[model samples]
Target: MGPKLPPARFVLKSFMAESGLEPRLLPHLRVTNAVEGKVDFELDITKDHTNRLKILHGGTIASMVDLGGSLAVASKGLFSTGVSTDLNVTYLSGGGKIGDKIQATATCDKSRCQYKTSIDYRLTGNEVGMTLAYTSVVFKNSKGELAARGSHTKYVSKAWQAQSEAFTLPEDADIAAEE
Candidate 1:
């Protein structure tokens, strides 16, 4: 059994509140699903998120990249998702207009267990980049048309390593705090 971490949605929503940038830009973004090293979000394309062309702004897509990566890292129990060391975004379509809904899925590309035995020195050993997370995001419109895709690399070693306490779950982790 691994450590008992807070629910993924809890970590993500709390991040939306605590992150200085997220509260200002994506105050209303909804976390639809969250799991270890992954998260999904849905948001309406508001005029505020558009450019002079009335299309979803490239800046907005980039911000989503950052947000998605951070949320994914937080889902791993690193509530304080570390600084973005790199970010790359590619615009595909218009993304959406002021009334369209878009969904974004963010996922971390690597994990300790997944690479545990691959290296002579394990990531679990807290060696170099023990908590570096390379995350990717895909954005799609309500019709399931691809809008944009992005990648983010963040250095989260501090927060990840600081989480020394582990709690075994009493049961499956899907249950909630309240209705």
Candidate 2:
């Protein structure tokens, strides 16, 4: 089959399109593959994303970790990936210099983010249900060497949240793709 679920990158791309920092900084990011709970991508390092040493910057890596986690959550069919609860990044290498393509894959380590249940709860019950998502990312250099790794957590328990299914559909999905 083509894919088990619709690629969530479209939603992510749309978000990036509207984001302030992402629009200027992550201009070169490309979603190679995206499915439920997983997202693979690549980026060509440029001077804007480098350090004084002319290699990938640590801040840039950190930013990618945040984005990767959001993308992973999006893979599970969530548009608003929620707020970051935690984020960690370990730089194994410099990734690469300008013009070098850095490949990365982010996988949802744990996910129970249900769109319908994200805000669902018993009004009378004092106990609240738990819904969260965790994602891990591995970055590789052009030579296939380990460049960096990271982990991220997102809290998607949208209290008083309101959402409609039609708000997140891709153009193709709402058109003839369903037939």
Candidate 3:
């Protein structure tokens, strides 16, 4: 074998530290696994994540879906920080309660290059080893039942490279030439 590859958890942890957003926006989320084009995330539903009904809030679930898909794309050893172009979620159940474990797995369905790279991702969730939701992917409650499913589309920037001035032209070149 060649040099041993780092475990997914370590790679994700390092990436999250560099990301500088997880600790703020998703303090409850944790990366359990990550590999090329795929990532798994888990969150323990707590009182803070619930709504008046004491079930997981829809907004929280949506955030998890978005993060899951984005991380899956990032796990490809590419730059993160892509902006979401579109995100859609469909709630199927209301089973996530406080103290329940929720898990999501995101998979990159397609990646394409344009002026900017675009990634399509699917997310799924499971709770207690049972399917919870499936859309682009799924979400599950602690008992392993579906909660929500979602899909996310993002435009990823290519690795930045410095451009020399000599090879560049100003945006107002046409007007300058006319003058």
Candidate 4:
């Protein structure tokens, strides 16, 4: 049987096509899978993403995983606004090169008031084989993988204050006010 589609899939799909988010977050962030509670994504490794070690930069992996989790929760529309309270990652392997596709899977786990999430990233190469580059990634690392293990907590917030959903910000909000 085919995978079940999430109610929010169309909204996210429209957001991607209309918002032009791919170029902003590296082409790899494009969503390849969007199920009821999960998302699958991929990124092609390139010189632009390499670090001094000539492998996939840890930061890139971190960002990908973080975005993956965010997208997962956003799919449900469970919270209006949210922030990563903590993020932990474990780098098991690394690879880099043009045309190298790295896949990542993200899921949301809201067991308590906070949203617990996790992401797993994998890189596959004909020469390097398949390697696990990241696991249990959050906004930052330190809490460690075992602690995360497909379950980490975050604080979800309201997206709107007293303004309407379609309300626009004040014209001078972007500019500094003179005394």
TM-score of each: 0.77, 0.80, 0.64, 0.54
- Model 3 lDDT vs. the true structure? 0.55
Q: What is the lDDT of residue 2 in candidate 4?
A: 11
For model 4, residues 69-97, the per-residue Cα lDDT tens digits are 65565443332224556666666544344
Q: What TM-score does structure 4 among the candidates reach?
A: 0.54
Tens digit of lDDT per residue, candidate 3, span 1-179?
A: 11111333443444456766655556657666555566777887888788999988898878777777656654443333256667888998874888888888777666332121123223332110011111255787777878788887765433211211111222442211000
For model 2, which pairs clash?
none
- Between the candidate structures 2 and 4, which one is better when assessed by TM-score? 2
Q: Judged by TM-score, which candidate is best?
A: 2
- Regions more than 4 Å wrong, model 1: 1-6, 112-129, 166-179
Q: State the RMSD for candidate 3.
A: 14.6
* lDDT value, residue 118 of candidate 2: 32
Model 1 is weakest, by summed lDDT over 10 consecutive residues, at: 113-122
The CA lDDT at 92 in model 2 is: 91
lDDT by residue (1-179, candidate 1, tens digit) is 11223455555556655678776777777777766667888778899888998878889889989988887766655656778899999888878888988899988876553222222324452212465778899999767899899999988666545455321232544434322
